[model samples]
Target: MTALAGLLVLVSLAALLWQRQHTLLTYFQQEEYDNTRFFTAWQNVRLFDLRATATIVVALVVIAAGAPFVGVKLALAAALAGIMLIERRYRFKKPLAMTERAKRLLYLSFALTLVLALLTVVHPLWAIVALQLAPVTLVLANMALKPLQTRVNEGYTDQAKAKLARLDPVRIGITGSFGKTTVKHMLAEILEASGSVFYSPGSINTVLGHTRHIRQRLQWSHKYFIAEMGAYGIGSIKRLCDFIHPTYGIVTAIGDAHTERFGSIEAIAQAKSELAEEACLAGGTVVVNIDVMQYEPFQRLKKIYDLRMITVGAEGSDVVVDAQETDGASWRISLHSKLGLIPDVTYDLPLLGAHNVTNSALAVTLSLVIDPEIADQIPYFTKTIAQVPHRLQVLDTPGSALILDDAYNSNEQGFMSAVASMDKLAKKRGGRRILVTPGIAELGLEHDRVHARLGEFCSDRCDTVYVINPSRIPSFAETIDADKVTVVEVPSFAAARAAIAKDLKQKDVVLYENDLPDLLEEKRLL
Candidate 1:
């Protein structure tokens, strides 16, 4: 019985750890292993999660009451097994590649579990109680492994830096709360005409991600390298800047995209401004979004780095977007620079949303600054700029449903812009506009207010709104009128897709807004 209990505890703990490894590591990485945030996320149990609570309580009680050792162990093992089974059934599993740091942490966690299990020889109660410390064990392991992980990361980063120094391409770093990827792709398209351009692919914006891209994909022949820099806290972008040493930079727009992790808008701006500051320090020109110039940080940046700064926006800026009008799945934009008013440049962009015009304007300004010879090619490149995979990409469906896919890293501003774009498309196609969303998540303290405002916005814009998650329904209910908008509640994405297919017809436009991964509670079927 003692050996059997030990085996059960070991197997159950292994299974649980395997399941939670990715989420645990992600939080650890994002929060920088801050105990406060780690513990908060660790213990963020759902209110009225009676099943989990009851299981924990009963296991403790049994161990405390000196129940048969095997029985108590069996109970704990059964509880863990139940949890693992439920997670496997309901959770969407993505292919998570464990980093060297993650692997070290995992090994440490397993060793801790084994050490605790060995205490079963003295008291089986020790093994039973060890299950409760799963989260704590991972935290302890991370704390232990951090120094070694840092050394390994630094070693690889140094090699990447050496490679970068040898090649010395014209590096342009782009950072902001949003639109960095779009701007990166836009700049890449324009600059390709000037020379061979290598931009960081997709959302590979972190320090390690950038290092890997540089070491593996960066080529000697590439004349321009655009690095998309992202940050979660202060100095994060500065760290990236220290490595790549960009010759030019663009601060797209300052917003509340990651304001939750940043704690405040000021902190977010400070973090994002690191890119421009570093670029200016390196004697490189920095392009500032004129709209965000109203912010104090950008104002401060301008005061200190005025010579290296160029502003772009709708009006009253160095690079001006005189007009932007959409004509059935394409955008017509007119741009002017300090040099002079360039002819009105119109392009059939695969992208949607007026916000993209701002991104495009920044890209165009930077391209002209880099190579004035590409001035005439601006219209051609803008017309041929391919659609970014998920950001406002249009999908071809076998059915007549026109699907506008904007289901990645959603923010309040982006969501509103998508809604406006959807409204326009529906009007042109003479179809009913439908919005299918689980609503946005990860706004932290601003979650309720943001969703409430989103609901209010959807009430007026969408003909039919299908809300997937029930947790968001209350916030939406606060502002949305059920009678005014045909609101349907769904338990899963499958169900939502089914409903759309049943009602979809030719010219029907369905805008899939912010999609949450299954790891988030908002994606769960209630």
Candidate 2:
């Protein structure tokens, strides 16, 4: 019975480690590790349900009372076997592979659990309780490995910096609350006309991710390297700049995208402005959207840096988007800049959303800064740009229905822009406008207010709205006029898809705004 309990404890610890690998790493990576966040996340999953908690508690009590160990051993073994079975059933749905540091932490956790399980011969309760304390073990293990991880990361970053210096590419740093990726891709496409260009792929905006990209992908043949810098607080972007040493920078737009983490809009701006500050300090030009200039910090940045600042927007800017007309998934815009390089320029943008036009304007401004001759050929280069996936990407269904897949990263501005674009497309097709979303997140204190506003905006534009997690937005029902629009609450995306298949017609337009991962959902663990 003792040996069997030991085996079960080992298996249970393995299962728990596999399931919580991502969560553990996320907590470890936090600026200040949050135990509350860790516990809250663990409690939301079935593997750490109340039954598991109670089993460990009972096992601890049994050992403390010096009762016959057979009953507690069998109970723990059975409970652990059940959790392993449950975890195995859903193992195929696992998320991304754990990082190297996370794998190291898991190995440490396994070693510690084994040490505790050895005590099962004397007291089986020790092993059982250790299984339940896997999270605490993970925390301790992470704390021990942090210093070593930092050293390894610094070594890798140094290697990347050495590689970057040898390649000698003209780096352009891009940062914002949102639209950074879009601008990065757009600029890459436009700048390709000038020479070979490379960009950090996907949302790999972290320090390690950027280091990996520079070390692995950055080639000597690439003339322009675009780095999308992301930050949760001040000095984050500066760290990336120190390594890459970008010659130019662009601040797309500042908003409440990461206000939750930074705690205030000013703090968020300060963090984002680090990119511009570093670029200017290197004697490089910085492009900013005029829309964010109303903020005081940006004004201060302009005064302090006294850098070559190019502002792009519809009004009050050096590079102006004169007029924009959207036709389906494409845009035709007239752009005129005070810089004279791009004069009364008319271009076709193969993208969606009005915000995209501004993003392209920034790209255009940067391209002109790089090579002024490209201005005359802006129309030719614009055609080479394509719509980025999941950022208002238009797809066609089997029944000729239009599916607007904007389900990637969600923020207030991006969500509203997609809704407006969807409404326009639906009007043109004379189709029923359907919206499927779980609503936005990460607004922190403003989560409810932002979601409420999104709900109100959908009430007017959508013919039928399928809210995946209606409870996520507590103020949703109050903001919407149910009498005017049909609102369907779904428990999951599967149910929403079923409803769409049953009701959608050929001319229907379905806008999938934002889909949250199951980890963020609120539910009973069992």
The per-residue C-alpha lDDT of model 1 at residue 114 equals: 64
Q: Across residues 453-507, which tens digit of lDDT does each residue of candidate 1 receive?
A: 9888888888998887766546975577777788888865668889898878888
lDDT of each: 0.76, 0.76
Looking at candidate 1, what is the lDDT of residue 479? 71
Model 1, CA-based lDDT: 0.76
Off by over 4 Å in 1: 1-36, 45-90, 338-348, 442-445, 470-473, 491-495, 522-526
- Clashes per model (N, Cα, C within 3 A): 0, 0
Q: Report model 2's TM-score to 2 decimal places.
A: 0.89
Q: After aligning candidate 1 to the native by TM-score, how far in Å is the CA of 58 from where it should be?
A: 6.6
Worst 10 residues of 1 by lDDT: 44-53
Off by over 4 Å in 2: 1-40, 43-49, 54-79, 91-94, 122-124, 304-307, 339-344, 522-526
